[model samples]
Target: MELTDNLKRVKKPDWLRVKLPTGKEYVKVRGIVSEHKLHTICESGNCPNMGECWGAGTATFMILGNICTRSCGFCAVATGKPKPADWDEPKRIAYSVKLMGVKHCVITSVDRDDLKDGGSIIWAETIKEIRAISPETKFECLIPDFAGKWENLQRIIDVKPDIVSHNIETVRRLTAQVRIQAKYDRSLEVLKRLDEADVKTKCGLMVGLGETEEEIYETINDLSNVKCDVLTIGQYLQPTPKHIPVAKFVHPDDFKKYREYALGKGFRFVESGPLVRSSYHAEKHIF
Candidate 1:
């Protein structure tokens, strides 16, 4: 069957429903984030489980800037001229984490092609600041591909985050359609670079973006070839009608099977399900 032809609306199974938002701690975290004028993927990216994640006292920091230079069809982040890097944003994030008493933190950002180093230097600084303030906290950087440059990738590796992640975003065949100027092999190389650095590497893919089952398995095999340590597979929920349309929603049971298959393929940790995101329950799964 053709990949785009896979479009078929399926019911959201029982396993997908989550508890609604309500928590005093969640409110406090939101207030802290607001006072700092910070941007988080939890809000800007329209993540499905923002309330649940914040309620648990964790948020994925969207550093560099909220605006993205690339217009990926699968994402909701605004596309425009990105603002200059905020040097103080790093220290603010460190202070916020300490205030939240978070044991671990996940930091991600939009594609900052407008910058000379693809904003890798800002990422490195942010990690350094976070480590200095909250020495006990573990940090994971979900980074851009630096437009596929080895030198740019090397810059962030120098910071030595606990986990370095670059999402393939979609299977090889659908990469051009789903992502903007992002190469499938280039992302694999990003993961490979982290693996070679002796740091834990993580990669994620969005299912139901019109990729074939064979393509998904091929993507998995490709990732395993790079020796990636962690994998996350989640359903694709179109952020808007203009964005890439969701072709199919895999059942939660199939997500389970895929998880088993990935684990059998030797990934140290695999998160697969309808609601799974790259940083979802990341702290629990990392150890």
Candidate 2:
């Protein structure tokens, strides 16, 4: 009975249904991604907007490697021992962005805990290389916390990606169960440091993970206190049965309320909805 009730609660709602993308542009982008051996969180993370982004001829490139060190419950990215950081990744990513001719590009990566510098050196080089070839293009880097090493974090800060993002993933109450090894306060510190640098800082959190409304507002208050520039709130979908099950499907109306509240708290931009992810509608947030 308990299992049946749980299954009922986890079923996806109608609003969450989406058609898979198909078009010449998506196929073209897929070929480019495959040809370059580039990794994209859009596919690795199992983001619902991957198809939509590809259909428009853009993609969020993932570096470091496809394998992640952490085992976050809500993520679809594979986890295991990752390969050594590839030195040539920056040039390949830059050329791919140039070839696609996108006005803006978002870059993200899996957690690489094995690295000494936490892959910060490659991160800095990637941004620099991208600027060298596509001087006109903009960058949004959704980065890791570097295991609380502020110096490693600074490498990314010095490069000056248009926006720096690191998702808290969920409210404080669910952080341990959802993000596993990630620390709730530490994620806040990551955003706080970015905010202090006077760079536009952003972070995302997923809903429908059994957190209360008050918990959500409390997370918002914490972000506001840190003066985070942008906030993205999205519904949590179960990537697999072995992963954490969805608590419930949050309604669109609740997402609207979240948007209004976040904006009131002084967020310059907020993307709140069922399909929103860390990089969803990323091009608009650069403003």
Candidate 3:
């Protein structure tokens, strides 16, 4: 289905509207990101929270490269043969975090399937560099599954970021449809392994992807079984005509219900809403 077709059939709800990016802090963060040749999921994914996050002087940095190897139907990150990994990228991101004076930073990246370790080396180095340069700043690594390679995941666990998050993206039935190359059970295993390693583990899911309420509750139970510490639920907006169309616009009340359900299910923290993203209100998840 084309983007225009979805637009014609489904009207965006009023609650989905977001403020245009502005303010000195937003501009300064934008400039720093540009000046340092850094890429962010905020701009790459066209996140609705970009304005608010950047305005607060916090942004999630996308490392390794802007291009991805997987063509997940729900993602907006470009997919293709990615450029070679940048060995110096870790130091640069570390310096950028120090310069931004970010108290709590979020780091994520495009899938680098072409790499041997799926860019886990860069992931670990980046965290180490940031810790060395800005000892007081806490950070979270929103990582990829690395095709469920335990050794590659070990690289990240060794660095010991405050939190390690791998997004489930959608329900089990929709995993193949939304995250074309990703496996739902494998993602659960990744979170489980992180929890086993004593690293704080987190996972995110997007609603409005044709998933039923029962399926969502089942997903929460699966995550809880693995001892997932934090959870984020958000409405999915189609980025282009080529992407999957929104199945529905969930109401704010439903989001609140989900949040309460997750909290009662033993999640340490939960962020749920129409505009929520994986990294929205990310700083609070540090606990």
TM-score per prediction, in order, is: 0.95, 0.97, 0.97
Over 4 Å off in model 3, which ranges? 1-8
- Residue-wise lDDT of candidate 2 within 24-74, one digit each (tens)? 999999999999999998888888987899999989999999999999888
**Please, what's the RMSD in Å of model 2?**
2.0
Note the residue pairs that clash in candidate 2. Answer: none
Q: Which one is best on lDDT?
A: 3
Which is superior by lDDT, 1 or 3?
3
User: What's the ranking of the predictions by lDDT, best on top?
Assistant: 3, 2, 1
Off by over 4 Å in 2: 1-9
Scored against the true structure, residue 54 in model 3 reaches a CA lDDT of 99
lDDT of 2 at 176: 80
Native-referenced Cα lDDT, model 3? 0.93
Ten-residue stretch with the least lDDT total in model 1:
1-10
| Positional deviation of residue 147's Cα in model 3 after best superposition, in angstroms | 0.3
Q: Which candidate do you rate higher for TM-score, 1 or 2? A: 2
Model 3, span 1-287: residue lDDT tens: 43224444468989999999999999999999999999999999999999999999999999999999999988889999998899999999999999999999999999988988999999999999999999999988999999988899999998899999999999999898788889999999999999999999888999988789999999999999999999999999989877888879999999999999999999999999999998999899887
